[model samples]
Target: MRGVDVLSTAFKNAFRSRLRTSLTVLAIFIGAFTLSLTNGLGTGINQYIDDTVASVGVDDVMTVTKASEEEPTDGPAEYDPNQIAADGAPGATATALTDDDIDTIAGIDGVESVEPSKSVMVDYVRHDDGTRYQLSVAEFVPGMRIELVSGEQVDLDASDPELVLPESYVEPLDLGSAADAVGQTVVLAVTDATGEQVTTEATVVGVAEPGVLTMGGAVPNDVLAAELYDLQTTGAPEAETTRYAEASVSFDTSGGATQTEALQDRLADAGFTGSTLEDQLGTITAVIDGIVLVLNGFAVIALVAAGIGIVNTLFMAVQERTREVGLMKAMGLSSGRVFSLFSIEAVVIGLVGSALGVLGAVGAGQLVNGVSGDLLADLPGLTLIAFDPVGVATVVLGVMAIAFLAGTLPALRAARQDPISSLRYE
Candidate 1:
């Protein structure tokens, strides 16, 4: 028989035992549906992480800090006056990066430049007669990208002190709306040295959406941060004001990963620790991927069970069609052709079941995505379940391959039957 003729005949025969074939197909459907959903979950989360990494960090910049040589003891050790408050936060001290350390880092190979990291603390923010709300402001870094709800990102080079308000702060601060807050003035009060209150006013340049990097804090440009830092340190010793907990080092990006590692090694040799954005966020991605892998294991187990069902279904079909096989052999059909016929039937069943499963998964994923979009409305640009065409295709083809393999034994038994003996038995 021609290939087309054989394929058509096999498809027709596949549903002869309707209930049995349906049960076997249902098993395969369960496995395919599960596999597709798990893959979609992984794709969606990883995509969101990729976008967040791009928006939050710069690839060519590394955050460098002086590594603490003092080992941890059972109790607090004697305080060293040389150590400064880390990030300028009260009660937190660390080995501060001084002017000498900055010069040493600049002299290191492959470093383009270094900027002292500043941590600005704002006591409270008040707009007009609105209530005073405690506000945490994050320092701005060059080349940083932030997702904005309205207006534009803070400009570090701008002469005036500019700040971006977080979405959560708008209503509480009585800023009206995100758009209305732009270009408005807000007062920030900070306590200077000698325990005196100091107030600084900054214009709102933009409003930012809630994000991983912002951590519910306001974002301040260089001018705003420098102004706040200066106010907070007024009347303090000049030597103490210059001390910093860390620095931002910009490096050559053309060298890629090898160059990045070399620069980090050089920093380590200088008694400093340098970490790129990937180093800081790698643990998050690793944990996410690991969870997806575990979930996939369960789907694979279901597929294996489905494979066994395919084997049993084909074996029964072979037994029930023993006479038909003998009659076909009695005609001009060859053993190879008989084998091909049975294999095609198995493939046809796999195609039907897998197609339905993939379609069903797509439907379910869309529904979940819609529901999650509302539930996670605060997290813009996130899809909870997203399907990739290539991944879905891989699942369908994999299930069909398993079905073909399971039919092999049955096809072989039919091929080996002796025509004269099989025809006389019934």
Candidate 2:
């Protein structure tokens, strides 16, 4: 028989018992459905995380902090003046970053520059409507990620006090929308030496969207940072004023990921630890990936069960068609063609099952995502289950490959049947 004839015969033979074929296909469908859904879930979440991380962190710069050497005691030790202290946070056992540390960090190989972090204390910040809210500021260091809902990033070099507002603050600040908030003047209040509230005005430069990695805090320009530092420490002594919380170290990007990691390793060797945005969020990503992996493993288990179904189904088909196999071989059909015919039947079953399963998964995923939209409204641009064409195709091909492997033993048995004995059997 010709190749086309063999294929056509195999396809017809696949549905010789419609109910039997349907049951086997259903088994494959369950596995494919689970696999596609899990893959889509993983893709959607990881893609969102990648986008947010890119928006909020710089790859080439590392945030450096002093390493805490554990002075193990019988229990928690009381305030000892011998060790360094965190300046902004009271009673925190943090080693304050000094000028010498900056010099040494700057002297490290591959380091381009070092910017010391200064903690600003603003008593309160309010819009023109005089509604005051609690104040906190984040620094705009190299590689820091920020996405503006409207307006531009903070002008760090601007001589005047420029501030970026988080989206959550736009409404509370009595600013109607993010767009209208830009270019408006906001008043920041601080306590003076006499413990009186001193008000200062700053221009609103941008409105930023909150992200998983981006803290929902405002960013003040260098001018504002210095001003807030001065206002907060005006009454405090010089010893307290000289201390810094941490510093940012910028490294050359010419070398790539390995080089950047090496620089961080070198920093650790010097009694300091450096972390990029990826390093900071590594644990979070790892957890997400781990959950996805566990879910995928379950899907794979379903697939393995489906593979066994393929094996059993093909084995039974071969048994029922023994006489037909003998007759075809008697009619000059080669063993190779017989084997190809059975394998093609297996392929058709896989194709039908995988196609239906993918359609089902996509429909279910869409329904879930649609219902979840309102619940996840706070997290904009998030698609709960998103299917990638390449990933989908991979899933389909993967199932088909498994089916082919499962059909091998049965296909070989059918190919090796004896024509004289098989034709004489009842």
Candidate 3:
């Protein structure tokens, strides 16, 4: 029989056995749907990570201090920085990062700029009700220009006392707006080098952009410093500063991979430890990818089960058509023609089932997203699920291959049937 004729006959027979054909198609549909959902989720996670990294400006590298050197002791040693500082003792022999370190980092190859910062814990007085809040004072060095929504960036050269606060703090205190908070004076109490509580008044200067505070627990670093320093008669003495933070070097480069590797090497050479946004994002992406892979494996098993069902159904069809096959052979139909006819039916079943599966998955994805939107509305950096066409196409092709293999044994058996013996058996 011609290929088209064979396909037509196979489809006709498939519809004639409606119940079995429907069950077989349903099996394929379940397998395809599962595979597509997992694949689409994986893609969505990757895209979300990429978006977060891009929004945060991954070209910059950050450096933070590691634990201090300590002599070997018998019992488990406490390593908390807060506890050590509370004990009125310096925990580490390693020197705090200084202007010299910043200069050295800036001199490195591919280094575009460097910013040094220092943070100290202090007490803040709420302007409206005079409630106390623990705050960290941060100093911003020159060349680190953060995007500001209101007012101006910290003036590294100006000795005038100024402070900035995060927008998050404004709403909790019933501070009407960030713009109103600007130019208002707030008092900050800080412990001096001699452990004396000194209060300083600083004028609010500006508000940082929302993106700056989205990832890490960031605040107005320079503003807090100005507040604490202005309150004290003798501002925080440099020698007594406990913790120092720095943005040692930032590059004007692109491509997260190359920049991360180069920055890691530079940090290691400078006796510091740090991580880039790309590294953190990569860790998250790897975990999501592993989960997707495990789920896909389960989906593959489901598809295998469906394939077996297809084989069984085709075998039953062959048995029921034994006399018919024998008659066709007697009428000069070739074995190759019989095989082609059976294969065509399997392909058609697979294609139709895959189409249904794709439609179902897409609809389900949309429904899930709609329900999740309300729950995720308040979550920062949350991403919605989406469908991927490339993944759908891959799943369809895989299903078709499995279906064709399932039909192969039955087709071969029917092709080898003997006309004269078969006619006599029944």
Candidate 4:
């Protein structure tokens, strides 16, 4: 048969045995569906992470801390007065980052600038005659951003103290809605270094929507954070007050991951640990990727099982068409043409099944994404399942390739038939 005739005959022949072909197609469909869905899951989650990275403005920022000098051992070492315990970790000690450390980080190659981070604690927050509620303030870095439901991010250069309230606090603080919370004034109570309570008033510049980076707390402008830090250290020694737990370092990453890694390595050699936002969130992405890989493994197994079905179905078709094959060979068709016919038929089956599976997966993914979008409204900008065109195409092509490979043995058997012997036997 010629090209068009071969293809037309192959397609017509593929479904001659309706029940058997349908079973084979169904098998391929299951594998294709599973593979597409898992790929979409990975794509969706990673896309969300990328969006968060862009939205939060932490793409080129790295958090740096003084490396601990204490060696690891089975037993705890003697306490050192100079080492300070991190907040929330009662007994864990960390080397403090001092002015010299900040200066050292600033002097490193590729470093744009450095800002020391300050830990500020607030006893309670009260608005007007509302009852006091405990609160925590997050340090505001220069390039960091907060997703706001109302108003704008805190104005770092503004002379007066300013802060952004978490959306959760609006109702309990009697601040009405997120919109109403903006421009309101609130009192923050804190204890000074002298062991005395100090209260400060700060304007609410914005109300932030909940986000992974925000850590479910109020965000403060540099001015407000400095004010709080100063108040907390009122009676403390100047040297002690300058020590910090960590610092934010801005770096040039135009050369990409390699350059970033080199900078981190340099920082490590300088007795500091530097981690980019991606580095901090790597564990989460790694876990997600691993889960996707595992799910894909199941899909691959299904595809392999489907390949066996293709093999069996084609083998039966070859047997049933033996007389037809003998007649075609007598009518001037070559063994290669017979092989091509069977292989093309297998491909046709694969195309039908994979196409159906891809379409079904896309439809199902959209439904799931819609339901999840509504259910996870708080986590804005997230799509639980998103399909990539390339990935979908890859799945379809992959299934078809498996089908072609599985039909090889059947095609070979049909090609090897002796025209005279096959015609004489039934």
Question: What is the per-residue lDDT of model 3 for residues 1-426, given as tens digits with 9 covering 90 to 100?
Answer: 776788889889766788998999999899888887787778866876676567545446554443244555889875644222321246533335555656666777666765554444565546645567665543343344444557666565556666566556555545568787777766667776566787766666776554422321223445455455444424555543433444545665575567667766776676655555566567788999999999999988998998888888888888888888888999999989888777767877787777788788787877767776777644344445567778888889888898899889988888888988767657
Q: Could you tell me how far off, in angstroms, the CA of residue 151 lies in candidate 2 after the best superposition?
A: 2.9
The collision pairs in model 1 are none
Query: Which residue pairs collide, candidate 4?
Result: none
Task: At residue 176, give the lDDT of candidate 4.
Answer: 93
TM-score of each: 0.83, 0.82, 0.72, 0.88
Q: How far is candidate 3 from the true structure (C-alpha RMSD, Å)?
A: 5.9
In model 1, which regions exceed 4 Å deviation?
54-57, 65-100, 190-199, 230-246, 254-258, 268-273, 278-282, 424-426
Better of 2 and 4 by TM-score: 4
Q: Report RMSD (Å) for each prediction in the order shown.
A: 4.2, 4.2, 5.9, 3.2
lDDT of 3: 0.67
For candidate 3, the 10 contiguous residues with the lowest summed lDDT are 80-89
| Tens digit of per-residue lDDT, candidate 1, span 302-383 | 9879888888988888888888899999997899988988888888888888888888889999999999989988778888
Model 4 backbone overlap count = 0
Decreasing lDDT order of the candidates = 4, 1, 2, 3
In terms of lDDT, model 1 sits at: 0.86
- Candidate 4: segments with Cα more than 4 A from true spot: 67-95, 121-123, 190-198, 231-243, 253-262, 281-283, 424-426
Task: Please give the CA lDDT of all the candidate structures.
Answer: 0.86, 0.83, 0.67, 0.89
The candidates, ranked best first by TM-score, are 4, 1, 2, 3
